[model samples]
Target chain A: MSDPAGVIAIGWPQLLLATGFMVVTGGITLALQLGVTKALWLGTLRTYLQLLALGLVLGWVFRLRQPLLVLAIIGVMTAVAAQTVVRRAPDAPRGSYVRAWAAMGLPALVITFAVTGLIVRVEPWYLPRYVIPIAGMVIGNSMNGVALALERTFADMDARENEILALTALGASPWEAARESVRTALRAGMIPSINTLSTVGIVFIPGMMAGQVLAGADPLVAAPYQIVVMLMVATADVLGSTLVVLLTFRRRFTPDGVFLEKGWRPHAR
Target chain B: MDVSGPSGSGKTTLLRTLARLMPGATGSLAVDGQRADTLAPQRWRALVALLPQKPAILPGDLRTNLVLPWRLKVERDVAEPGSEALLSALDEVGLGGLPLDRDATRLSVGQQARVALLRVVLTGPRVLLLDEPDAALDPESSSALAQALVRIAATGTAIVRVRHRESDGLAARRLVLTQGGRLTEAGP
Candidate 1:
């Protein structure tokens, strides 16, 4: 009874259902005199425009599977992700952008290669349809982990300056001095992944699995892909955040093992 | 030697700099004729230690807090202190008979101060920089600390103490750190 050719297509009239819901939410906010009505309208408009642009660009990219184009796309995505991490983590130490880039890009690239080449084995390995989405997922999640780790680690150090100073006075290396904060930051970074892992199936269906099922794939087949993707995401998040925290912590201290008193403010450049 | 200054003066900062724990400090620092920055940071800190006004008692039993310096690779030159040595150190600082396994974080300020000093003594630094080390001590504990300082000094270790009160007969020379950041001898 289901058409197995492809997914059910969404047209403009059908898209009105989502638009109507957004209007209703915005209307309610206006009626309640909440200041967020403008924000709601603006956010919805932005999302619609952004997604439309992305759809057009992706359509063009999906047709061109050249490796150079794919690499360029990944490079831009990684640069944007690194910038986002720096912006979100206000307390992150100075000169953290480069470290953020490496933290986000390295593990994401590795995992993307492993998932595409080893696991999914997509033809050409640079097929935009497969690689773009997978790399986006990896980079986006790793970016979040890096942001959480940087913020949490710096906040902890600020709160426990005396404690860290005591360790420094007692001949502890900067790494040793900040060990507690590092552990806490790493745990904080991994929390989202851990939560997603624990709640994936029972609480709610994940987007990828739902998308695959709606596209007429067997639920059983879609489930395995979701499991694999989730595992890869968790691994990328942990590894990326760990490396980010370790590298960033080193930058927080001078070579003489002193905690930088200015406390990792971003450089003017 | 004694370093006395007003509340806002930079006595603590100077001691931390001397211990090579403050990076932005501008000056040359040499420990035992070797440039402080030239030596490995961990090694320099082991040789030149600082005891702050409020020392952090790490989350563990008292014994673990005392032996943490020994656990670090930088302190490999000093063999791990046995329980006998630890008890002797504690007794020398007037904190004898306390259980080694008791949670250190719960100790009173005075007791914690003694434990912190005992830790520095166990490490056997060539120079000890103490910031208000006896601020929380009672007369008996203060006397005990003074005696411990004498013993540590007897081993040819240099001691720099920061105090607000009059010199307690321990310092060889007294320099009052003025509000202007100048160190003027206490006596006119």
Candidate 2:
């Protein structure tokens, strides 16, 4: 039996071994594509730097151990990230960032908090290890899913406005015109996540579970946490993406319910 | 009357501006005494549609091309009722016996123009704006199209037809467009 209370110092060797699979594949992909290789190198370096810097910032902040402060930081981080996602997506309607965050934030907060609170019996739920990492990961993925879902769905709305209008003339409501886009885009966004979900244990052990195990915790505890994370991911994606689409649609049409051309502007920017 | 006075006329521009796929347009547009921007152009647009000189036929099954316009809300959904009769209205145009299921995108250029015309007619719009509508037609198709336009006009539909050669034996008001976007009548 190990001392479950102790903190693990993750050495560089273990880190290399843990990340080797991803890094090797990324390098290979970059090597195969000429220009993409440069982008890959820069992106990898930037990501490494950001993670290191963020880890330091989070380490200092976590020492304070105030739950309210932690919650406030999470809110700020999510808000900033959500705004960036919207801004990067071209032809994203006005007020998309604010609206999508408001929609995604609700379900992510409620479900993650509920599951982690009741299921994981971490003494300080605000701990950097227990809640912060999990929240950061879950919320980050949720933001991406919501952005992709919203972007694709909005583009579809613009491109197919004529068909949608034709349906409207045939006495179908706005939602009916929107239903195909929403369904198709949301389903498309979920593909990667679903692949990850389905292949969790067999294809590769997810980082959280493997990390917990390597740190020498009981596999049982690590398993439950991994299960919880996957469930939270599904909930976040379904609820967050769907809400954004719904809210975006409300803005998609005119006062009398005409689908706006601006709704479909490709995120060329 | 459905005619353009001469070359360099604002006829195409006038039709395109109303269709609002035009560039460099700024002004108020009134339709049925209402604001232009307020209307669902894709839906009610066909009501005053301007068929392009070379109409674009989207790649898809013939049925998809034909029924695509009826899916708009302003033309079908918001109306009191009877919008459902739109599909059968295809027969009312010259496409009468052609398989209702032909690939529109693959239709020969001449056939595509006719299918496009059929699409406009099915919408049952109030006006027709044709831009060199017969430039791609065979003599037979040209004759057929001319007859179709006359019949559609008989329905009291407002027709704004543009062409290089002036139409004969039709009640028409000729307004030529000169260089620099000017509209003029055939010499006073």
Candidate 3:
């Protein structure tokens, strides 16, 4: 059955049919004694439940269409993303949650608004449908970037402690001593986005593009949106990673430019 | 001057502290009557350079390693040595035959130690902190390093050399670190 939007409706039967595919995969895993059988079933269950909950939440937000509610949801999403970043990078020093929040939130919000307001030209600019999805993608990608950067910077600093000390002893400032580590972290953070940009549409169809096509948008129209999504994701990733790295590297040194070895080491507790 | 002590006596820690590379170190330090606290850390480090025991070679050839200090903002106003000056500096350190294009990472431990020393020396520190500069060197290379240190000390730059051996014929005054970390004056 088709809805008024002319998109074919997917009912529980179709969803259950999809679950059958996962069941077949789970069966193979069990047959092979792959340890991931439990993970596969648990992940499949969570995906179904989480997406359904997201659909209900989005429906409620869209119906009310209040800007404040939209913003509150965005705030919650950003906070969760920030916490996820810190959690993923367990080696990051203490008090990184606030820094991660700022790093991920600021650029992601700015870019989301810029895209929705300027590029998509969504009316009222706070339309839940446009802002939430766009902000979700931006914050999600930015979170990944920030997490990778924090992890890489801490690991690199620990590994190259001697090199950093050598630099400082040569009259290099703290920034100068940590420069190589920062560069490596930024590269690590941005490389996935760079690869996505280069290989988009050829290696695989991105999720947003696939969704838009499945909803019956013109391929040409959907292509530009996907392009915008890819570009914005790349921009947000680089900016977030840069901010996190800059914020965190200084913590590796004292104000006097001495490399504090204990500062970057993962705490025993 | 030479700083000597048995192993585990905090000799390396002393040199690191003097160069202001130790964060836990506390006490007043002065250079040429100027207090260390009054100086920017970069400036303080430029005045007092430390050569760590392990040689750290940057990812480049010999020329890049030698010229690294000059590239730092703290050394911006200082003149970078020319190829001739760098060549001669290598010569002075008994690495006369090493090529400027030679990859620094490929150098022997002893050779890299000398290059590490040369890297710090090029910064023209007023106080040089060497942590066992001769630890990896052969007798011939060690002697060359001693001569170089003597010449550098003659230029009025206070040199602090940490040595495991009793004699290098370079120190006019010596200090010894006891097991308890007390420093005592010893006759040269």
Best by DockQ: 1
Model 2 TM-score on a 0 to 1 scale: 0.70
lDDT of 2 by residue, A182-222 (tens): 88778866776777789899989988889888887798989
Candidate 1: regions farther than 4 A off: A1-6, A262-269, B35-38, B75-77, B186-188
lDDT by residue for model 1 over A113-196, one digit each (tens)?
899999999988888999999998888766777788878888887777888888888899888899999998899999999999
Pick the winner on lDDT between candidates 1 and 2. Answer: 1
- TM-score for chain B in model 2: 0.78
Model 3, residue pairs in steric clash: none
- Rank candidates, lDDT, best first: 3, 1, 2
DockQ, model 2, C-alpha based: 0.12
**Candidate number that wins on TM-score, 1 or 3:** 1
Please provide TM-scores, in order, for all candidate models, with all chains considered together: 0.94, 0.70, 0.94
**Candidate 1 structure quality by residue, lDDT tens digits, B63-133:** 99999897765755578899998988888888889989999999998899989988887888989999999
All-Cα superposition RMSD per candidate: 2.1, 5.9, 2.1
Pairs that collide, model 1: A94-A264
Q: Candidate 2 docking: what grade?
A: incorrect
Order by DockQ, highest first: 1, 3, 2
lDDT of 2 by residue, B52-122 (tens): 67665656765666666654444442232232443444444445555645666677787778777766655
